[model samples]
Target: MHYVTSKTLLSSNNGMNLYRGCTHGCIYCDSRSECYNMNHDFEDIEVKQNSAELLKKELLKRPKSMVGTGSMTDPYIPIEKNLKYVRKSLEMIYRYGFGFTCITKSDLVLRDLDLLEKINERSKAVVQMTLTTADDDLCSILEPNVCVTSRRVEVLKTLSEAGIPTVVWLCPILPYINDSHENINGILDFCIESGVHGIICFGMGLTLREGNREYFYKKLDENFPGLREKYVEKFGDSYTVSSPNNRELMKIFKKRTDEKGILNDNDEIFRYLHNFPQDSVQTKLI
Candidate 1:
């Protein structure tokens, strides 16, 4: 809910975060990790006042690459309905003839479908959505302020039908909470039906660090009472709080994704996401 003038926009790797903090009340958000060093409250979103202009500058100077956003914060937060920073950036990216991709959990992305379709037509545009759980009730608990799982699946399918490829981040699977076979299978079924181009799942567990770990534990105590003690006993001070069923869950994940021919390899998917497609009609830079 605050604004600051930023000097730069895109990263050396062609990624940009239009906002610094997030409003999405995800209980397992790793962006709150102490490693990031945010100066404001997590919910007090910090908007880059000059994002569109800065992005246009960056896009004009750099060679064509897949520009990405929403790494540290979701670009489609409710404020986006008014701020339109993400939409403006997409306009610049499309106008500059750069491929675009973003990771988000909001259906508000549908608002910019026109620009996304245009970018994909000129170069490439991939929309990546995160689906943590298939159960809408659990999704409300885990990623509380965003669209539910079913709605995100609808968004994915909508993007697919629009000829825009999509990727899904199936991650942060909490142990004892959402690590069962039924949960993983349900999420995987949703992905398969949505025709997602790739799925990036590091493992069947979530990471916990100094800042995020405490916040996650606090939420756990509030929601799943006494779960904090269980975590302390199981993964005292570990960063990667992996699920006990990581092996078995990963087995199901790999089998389902592989059978559906969806991209499951992280490196391969990153390559697909990062490597700017040099297709005949899409290579001309503005």
Candidate 2:
């Protein structure tokens, strides 16, 4: 909800965050980790006033690469409906002949379908959506501030029908909450039906750190009631906090994705994302 001028945009690897912090209110958000120092409140949403101009300048100077966003914050948050920074950035990427990709939980991405399709037709554009649980009720609890799982699946289907490739982040499966065979199967089924090109799952468990860990535990106490004590007894200041069902859940994940020909490997997906197609006609203009 605040604006500040940004000196630069785009990282060495061609990523940019148009906004710092987030309003998504996802209970397991890692961006809140103390490792990433944010001077503002998590929900305040610091807008980079000069992001569009800065991105245009950087795009002109850099080699054609896949430009990405929504790493630290969801670019399609509610504020995006009015700010429209993400849409502006997409236009610049398309105009510059750069491939585009982003990680988001909002269905509002559909609003920029025209630009995304144009960029994909010229080069490449991948829409990466996160689907943690198939149950809409659980999704509401875990990612309270964004769209539900079924609606996101619909967005994926719409994008696929438009001939745009899509990817899904199936991650941070909380133990004793969503780490069930039924829950995992439901989510995987949704991915397969949506025609997602890949699923990035680190494991069946979520990670906890200083800032995020405290916030997650607080929410657990409020919602799950005494789940915090169980986490302490089980993890007790550990970083990874992997699920006991990780092995079995991963078995199911790999088998399903492999059968469906959807990628289950993180490195493979990363390569797919970072590899910018050089066939773009716009590349010649630049």
Candidate 3:
């Protein structure tokens, strides 16, 4: 909830984060890792007060491309209800004739459905949502601050109905916790039913670095009792924590997504996301 004047908005890759840090109390947030090096508390939320203006300048200078956000933090956190920086930035992106994409887990995205649809019509607008667990109660524990999985599915359906392509991030499977076929199948079923364009799942595992590792372990100790000790015994300090069922679960993920004609390959989905349609550029020129 703090604002600071920022020098720039978009990265060389055309990605922009309207806010830094997050309020979404996800126990397994990799952004909390020390490698990112945020100066303030994770919940403090650094705001780029002049992001809209900076984005306008950047967009006017560059050719039409897909501008993405919410990689480092969710732009639709509760603070967004009052700040509305994301909404303002969307207006700027649309006004400048650039494509837009975002990764979010909150139903708050529904509030901006009008603008997303408009951008899709003019260029392209893809909504990428992360669905870690299908169980609502488990979802609440894993991602405490955002909307549940079912609600996120509804948001995806609504976006699809609006003609906006949707992508799902099925990740951080939290080995030994949600690495079950039932959870994977449940989430994939939701994706198929919602008609998602793709699903990105690296594997049935979660990574833990220094900062996030401590936080995750602490949460496990608090909630799951002896689970922290079990993790320590199994994976002393390894960064990548893959599940025993990673191979099997991946098979299910690939089979389901492939059968439904949904994009499951990470590279393909990223290429699709970063690609700016030629028609959009042509329309901009016209």
Candidate 4:
């Protein structure tokens, strides 16, 4: 973990990545891709030492809107236990009356449940969790370093009970691995039980770019021997690796989400996430 003074925090889209790299060690992490051109090791974790102040600066001048993170990297990695950068930023977001959202796989998010509930009451706070597979054993093999699917589900339920909305990211369905009806159904069942507001799944596949592809193949060889050769023979440098059962699997996904009335359309979900309730804004000062 290293700290550097950053000139800015929020992106043009209003997202802020307080930490640049991650320590959760998910094998299929797209952030490791060379296209990102990260200057240091993926585990080094660049910290914006001034994130709270920087974010406050922007939040003060800007009109109320949603502020998000966890697109480029997970903010609740182990080091966050002590750093508390995410917690600090959330305090500021609440102080300035901006909505909040995040994508993470760790149960540590529950530690901020108090702040999340407070923000939801004042404005909005939506937590988006990644659930790639339902089976804990397979989840261990795929995500490796983070909490399992069951634990994430529990967190989602807890958040929902607190009146904070939650979303699930069902993605990177490794072909020939987790692309089964049983796996999809198991995950959707968890979502329904957790009462998630939406589930974002872009087909039944994962993207494999240059940097992440190599790393993913290495992990596959170590865990599922001969899997790398199979992927190479099939995908062969393609960026989007769709599963053979994409059509069928998507049918199951849509049917389950539709029946439950969960948001299935990506655009609608994103719009919901970004569209702050106009009436929720107020002059809450720190």
Residues 77-134, candidate 1: write the lDDT tens digits. Answer: 8999998888888877887778989999999999999999998888899999998888
Worst 10 residues of 1 by lDDT: 277-286
Q: Deviation in angstroms for 3 in model 2? A: 1.2
Top candidate when judged by lDDT against the true structure: 4
What are the TM-scores, per candidate, against the unseen true structure? 0.97, 0.98, 0.97, 0.98
**Residue 25 miss distance in model 1 (angstroms):** 0.2
Tell me the spans in candidate 4 whose CA falls farther than 4 Å from its real position: none
What overall lDDT goes with each candidate model? 0.90, 0.91, 0.91, 0.92
lDDT of 2: 0.91
For model 2, the superposed segments whose C-alpha errors exceed 4 Å read: 283-286
Q: RMSD for each model, in Å, please?
A: 1.3, 1.1, 1.5, 0.9
Worst 10 residues of 4 by lDDT: 277-286
Per-residue lDDT value at 149 in model 2: 95
Best by TM-score: 4
Q: Which is better, 1 or 4, measured by TM-score?
A: 4
| Stronger candidate by lDDT (1 vs 2) | 2
Model 1: number of clashes? 0
Error of 2 at 91 (Å): 1.0
Q: How accurate is candidate 4 locally (lDDT)?
A: 0.92
lDDT of 4 at 188: 95
For candidate 2, lDDT tens digit of each residue in 1-286? 8999988888889888998888889999999998898988999989999998899888889888899985789889899999899998887888778999999999899999999999999999999999999899988999998999999999999999998999999888999899999999999999989999999999899988899999999899988998899999999999898888999999999999999999999999999999987766774554
Q: What is the lDDT of residue 116 in candidate 1?
A: 94
